[model samples]
Target: MDHQPLVSLITVNYNGRAFLHGLLESLQACRYPHLEIILVDNASADDSVAFVRSHYPQVQIVENAQNYRFARGNNIGMARARGSIVGLINNDVVVDPDFLQPIVAAFAADAELGAVQPKVLDLQRPGYLEYAGACGGFLDRLGYPFLRGRLFDRVEPDLGQYDTPLQVFWGSGAALFLRKQALEQVGGLDEAFELHMEEIDLCWRLHLAGWRIAVLPESRIWHYGGGTLAQHHPQKFYWNFRNNLFLLIKNLSANRLWRVLPLRIVLDGLALLNELVRGKWRHAGFIARAYLWLLAHLPLLMARRAANRPWIARGAARTEALLYPGSIVWEYFLRGRRRFADLKYSQAFTRRLAYGRHLSPTQMEGVEQPYGTETV
Candidate 1:
């Protein structure tokens, strides 16, 4: 690879002309010299396509006739990417000019690194972290995902506590940095997910294939959470509930899946009950429908499992190393352990976490050296 490799930053826009100006201005200011911007317009009825063509003639545009949402839309852009490094940035984000530097450096340093995400702050409230992906993503044994600085609905302030870069389980789709070769090996994002949990699934596949995903705190970006799907929208709930199940079914090893899936079903039911009790009947209904959809589509889910098996067989298959063994739901709701640091992590996981700690300047420069496997 070149010292400053070509980075293809792909943003999928769906009637988000309002957010384009900030995104374009930030891209123009980016210090990276070999960057190319690709805008995949998901059949936006707005003047989004015309606006990009008029204002940013240098950007490559992929026009889709219908709204493909996140999974398929990003896959289309990834396919068209000419860079060794492919970036997935949401239209709702404004990136720091220097964000690409650390990302490029990290990728050059580590051959096994599949993806990297910047420190994501709230666009509306710059002092706080964003809910979508605060500082890279981690999942519990049951596949409940939470970030370093954000847990479920509770997002923490950016206190520099999570400033240390580390190997993470997943990179957020909102502002994802990926390696083109790794994506091709894993067959890109699962279009079936449509929107939610797709990034996590991709990262899981990468991990199984002997690649690492990471977070770079030195780089930062602000995200306007829920640009396409509002927090209160019933469709968001449906996708979140339904696709999360799909994620576990597709990626988790068979031995692990059989043990954890039954518990996940019960936990999901409790979530639905909580929604109903809170008088959010519509959200509750979406959860019920999500379950029904999953049950009706078992064959489809099974097909996905079969397709993903070859990668898992070839991979290190160390899923337990990155997974938090305790149930996040039990800790957050029942035990009131909201802060990431407050939880009592097992000694085994603490050692693994230590191995995944951020690289020092010296170590960063030396990352090109062969890396050994961590004990799972």
Candidate 2:
């Protein structure tokens, strides 16, 4: 309960009133004092706006005129936050009562740590940790985000196995703790992303700026999991794939891009063909356009990367040796286990966890989503 406040927890809501209500209630139960809660509603049609206005009078609200989508919505809320630290928790997630304090303390404990994500449980299945961010997230060489507790759709159960706090390539936005200075230095999440993979883009910018990211095991949150793409929304597919391709074009060095983009493109072609065979026309279009979009907008992405090149190229640290991409990515989709976790320092290696602390009443093993009464 410091006077200036320590962290501002922001949640973006879109047609998920019941879920946001639960999420806010959990925040109400949190032990941290001097916390500011900002709820950005993406033009909900139902009683969501009215419900929060009537019930949660104490929370700050930003009611957008129309759906700005997740990325823009969060960017709006985050920019308005007054605290030095910002907590980006999904509206569909519920945090443990003891979560915020430890996370804030961790930030206070280390000046270099730019961001941290809490251990996340899957609400739909209590015993299984959510794949979105089991103990933080990582990217293989190809820009695929696979959490330590999960690789793709494969999620592991928690049994006090991953008990220690660890550093991660990127923190999960599901319940991420971020430094405001870093956001100011790099700007908030990319509005171009519109959603999906935006957090990775933000973290990579932080890394280039010499900030560290970590997973705080002491804090715990349970996410409903894949709230946006629950059934493959077109916007979801488009943003996830497009932003990933953009990540490569915008962040990777030119030499690296020229060396490996062709293989990645081939993989994407196969994915598009498979989607086309399944009659997922939009999905296929998404994959096809991801590359086309990159091609069309190469000038802009190149300009952005060129602006960043000077900062990275001038860094004293060696950049080429630890830069592992295709091998790590190939393992994520083809080999399953992260090949670099055992290696320690590889210019950029991958790491994942399969454990987290449980907080639900079930006291069960994983990500359980018991909605009390609400249905999907």
Candidate 3:
């Protein structure tokens, strides 16, 4: 651990010129000595490539012929990366100068650790957690993804809670750090995901391969959330609903799939109805479109599940340890658990914390209370 491993930091951009100054400047000031920055442009009409080349000459640029969006763009950049540890950061994110040290230290400490995410706060809102990735990401039994400091739309403030480095089901793609070997073992990101939920899908595959994902709060970043796609955009809604179904199909086991898919369809129906009742016609229409897409592509989804069967069997026994046993949708809508700390997780999640065996005493020092104790 004496010699620092090379860290290749890659950011995918599509006409995001205004945000580049903050991101690149912060990266230039990074304290980690062994770091290289890569900028992957997705055929932006804006002069994003020229701007980077002229201003940040040290950054390596990879230009795509067309807009490949998130999954494929990062995949292309990762292919060109020579670092042992690869970090996929969003173009709108600004990192702390010493962020890379803790991330690298965490990987050096645990051989099984495959991915890590920093505690992401809002760039616009000083104290609040960002919507994309708060402390770390997790899932419910029903394939609903949520974060430690964020529920559906409610985000918690930085109050010294969630300070410990702990194992999680997934890390946020906005500032995700991964071992290149693990990414290759999992065959990299599933490009079919296109945009939304791709990182969660990648983390699911890593879990299936018995690699742990964690959040190191000591390394921090600020995200200008929804820089590429607006939060309420219809396309964002469509991708979220559709890609979530894709995620569950590609990763869940057969028995769990049958039990969960039917219930999820019913819940989606309820959501559509609620959206229509609230006069949100476009959102409701997109939800229906997602269902139609699922019906049309059943064969493709089934083939994907079949291909992943071997890994599914390998990880089946420990799956429950990473997932919340209850439904997050029900907890959020019916039980009024808006904050992540308000939901009561089962013992399975508690046991999952034991996976953080490599966490140093200093990292766990001030974590005086367990989760669900401090409700905002």
Candidate 4:
């Protein structure tokens, strides 16, 4: 126990009392001794706050005035956390007894390791991968997010295909384990995101700051997906699309931004059309609204860039290697490449990962070049 670091685990709860008992009970089973659970309740109207206070007095509770959403809610907990390591987990997940072991080990193994996500399996179907983040996340050339065991809508069975630990583009926020140092360095999560895709943005910023994000399949957790929002909810669609666009604009270098942003727009159009064809007219409307909102909030986007200047100034190393060289949308929709193994990367990508580690000093020597179109 002396060798283990104290982990301050935080869960964002919004009317999630029914699942709280299970999560708390599962955590009670964890063998890790140096741990503290912090529950951030986003003004839960139900008896969630009362229940935690009654049954789990040991847990620290942060009550928000209103629904601050995921990013802000977790940021609040991080501010109050006392441990060196921080864990941002959803209220709907249950962890194995050994979950914290591998995570602690991963951080101890690499000084530059900023965050690690466990192998998230579907709670209902333990044999299958979860929707939030199966084994680790990767960004396609078009800025589309996909997991090692999951494509657009396909969740694969857990046959240990992604068992090996490796560097990933992003770690899922569902059961995210992070270093407090890294979290503070990048100013924690971006509040503008409010909900979806915020974790990806945070991880990408960490990458730019010369930190690594890894997936530790050796540590496992079962996530009851869609706890806060339904899979097909229009609000979910709005946040995902909007925040993804924000990531492309705010995070990408000027040269790469110009090249990828146009393709992303066209790809988004195709997705909207597909939704219309499938009679998901409301979803299509959500996407349109997201685009219109982005256009109107150009000033806000500029402000975000200014906020992210610290991480941007740190530059990037090995970040480009984590991205899928091919377009995932085209491969999934046209070529029907549902499995991650089916997706292809150029030989240069393999070589890049091989030699990327040694190029760290050169990459971190400078800041990202600006687009020069407008100032924040």
Candidate 5:
């Protein structure tokens, strides 16, 4: 697109020999031109090296000294990528033959576009969509994640409802294509986040810097969900819980955090309690450890906030967007709840603030919203 080799499809792999073969084969079979194929192996103990050497010698490869987690693997690929647009594809995905053409065209059409994600369906279940990038991701005020058509872990089956391409807060890293500028600005995925939510964090920083993200419904990919970690895997639980808390504290302002401290504590406590009741003792421990990890890393987060304050705070007073919720009520009830219409708040607040009318008194410091400032 635009006469440049616009896209570099980068795949990250770790011990997925069987899956990797299918991914590579599908990739080689794609019709899209002006693209380079890259594979980043995170020091797998399997015969991945020999397999690549035997079957896919033409593709560029990077072998890490040890197992680099998803974040690091992506970062390494980013550093090595030569194209202006980089496609961060998972080794477990099989994309359509013509997928890259429209994706590259999307970036060419919009200067503000930072990232675009494809609709990922289940490989085993055919038309069934995966939960990873359900109609693009959004953030509640307290750093909890929700999508336009999906929330929590409840995935909505594809009804062909999200067929129109629209701007979203973030893209799923699985089959995402991102502009190079945003990654350079945000400094790639935070190394602190080894696995989950790294793509969202990368897009959040991009948005904060005034970039945009979009979902291309026309482009499709089949994802073998839970390739690296199963749904209830302990490491998955740990990283998901830990990164949620870390990102919330790292991104929000001190004043906003103070305004909703009690509410956040109650919500987190409930989550911990639910885990305990369901006989998921380790899940509860992960939640507690997430808090403990964030508590210990508060100083580092504060230091980061101080440094980036100059970039966004240059001349702006307050940043606002639909993606940034005024309160958790918007998340819990107003979001995806058909019966929320008759609900009325007893106490009235000023203007359009959702649940700010009855804010908790024990709000913590530095808790501004973690919503991306980008338009898309």
Candidate 6:
């Protein structure tokens, strides 16, 4: 940590001209000495590239001939990145001046650390946690990803509840920090994902390759949440459902995959049924289409699974050890556990090692409460 390592900050933009000023302005105030900024423009219809060229001439620009969406756009930028540490930041996010320092320090502290996510607060809502990634991300037994400070639609207020740096299942894509070596080892974000859940998929591979992912709460950023696709967008639903299945297929061990996947499909069917009962035809259609896509692409998914087997065998840790043993969906809806603290089964997650250290329930005291302390 004697000398600052060169850090490349890459942001993918698509018709995000209006958001560039805030993001670029905030980055200009960053305290990090060795910093490189790159913007990957995905054929933005707006004058986003021209505006950056006119205003921020120091920033590097990579223009795509057509819209490559999130995953591929980021991959393109990362490929052009020269720094040892590369960051994939969203165009709509604004960071704290000292954010890059902590991220760099975390990487310097742990050689196995593959990725890190800063504590993300909502830009519009002040102290509330951002919906995409609050204080890192964790997955339930069923492959449902949720955050420490935000579960489903419930986002917690940033009251220093999760201030400690802790190991997590995945880092948020909105403002994820990555080691260039790790990216090379596991490969870039899956282009097939195109958008949602791609970061989770990448982190899952990192874990399988014996790399650690964590949330460094000391560094922070505020996100506008949905810049390209709105929360309720039909495409978002399709990608979330479809890519989640892709995630499980590609990463889950053979012993667990059979048990978990069928249950996940059943849950998706229940979700589709609920939407149908509510007369939400579009939502139901999206879910149904996800199933159809799965059926049509079974061979492709099997190939991806076969490709990832070596990494899975190389990993010393069990994927299930890092996952919450219970169902997040049942705990949230059926048991009425809204806050992350209210979930009793979270205590089971202490079995996993984080950042090369064993973390017991006592070690994660403030971050997670003891079981049965609160009731519905």
Q: What would the per-residue lDDT of candidate 4 be over residues 87-191, giving only the tens digit for each residue?
A: 999999999999998888777767788998999999988699998989889898678999988997899999998776666789999999888899888778888
Task: Give the runs in model 5 whose Cα sits over 4 Å from its true position.
Answer: 260-262, 312-320, 324-376
Model-by-model lDDT, in order?
A: 0.84, 0.71, 0.85, 0.83, 0.70, 0.85
Q: Please provide, for model 5 over 1-376, each residue's C-alpha lDDT reduced to its tens digit, 9 standing for 90 to 100.
A: 3655647778888998879888888888888777788889998999987898789887889999988889999889888998888889988888788877767767777776788888877787666667677556666556676664455565556778666566666788888888887778778888878888888877767766777677777788888888888866765767887787666555555555555456777878887898999999988998888888878888887776676566445312232242445444453555544211221321121112221111212121233435433221
The weakest ten consecutive residues by lDDT in model 5 span: 346-355
Judging by TM-score, tell me the better candidate of 3 and 5: 3
Q: By TM-score, how accurate is candidate 1?
A: 0.93
Which ranges of candidate 2 are over 4 A from the true structure?
1-5, 231-235, 277-279, 314-329, 332-376
Per-model TM-score versus the true fold = 0.93, 0.84, 0.93, 0.91, 0.84, 0.92
List, residue by residue over 1-376, the lDDT tens digit for candidate 2: 2433568888888888878778989888988877899999888887887888899898899999999877898989998899998988888898899887777766666666688888998898988778778877766555566666775656778765555676667888788888888788877887777777888878887876777777776778899976755724655666767788887767665655665578777877888898999999988887777777777887888787777676555431322222333455456556556432432333223322222232101111232222111110
Q: Residue 325, candidate 6: how far off, in angstroms?
A: 1.2
lDDT of 5 at 225: 80
Q: Please list all clashing residue pairs in model 3, or write none if there are none.
A: none
Candidate 5 lands at a TM-score of 0.84
lDDT for model 1: 0.84
User: How well is each residue in 210-289 modelled by candidate 3, as lDDT tens digits?
Assistant: 88888998899999988899877877778889989899888886767777889888888888999999999999999988
Model 2 CA lDDT for position 230: 73
| Superposition error at 364 for model 1 (Å) | 17
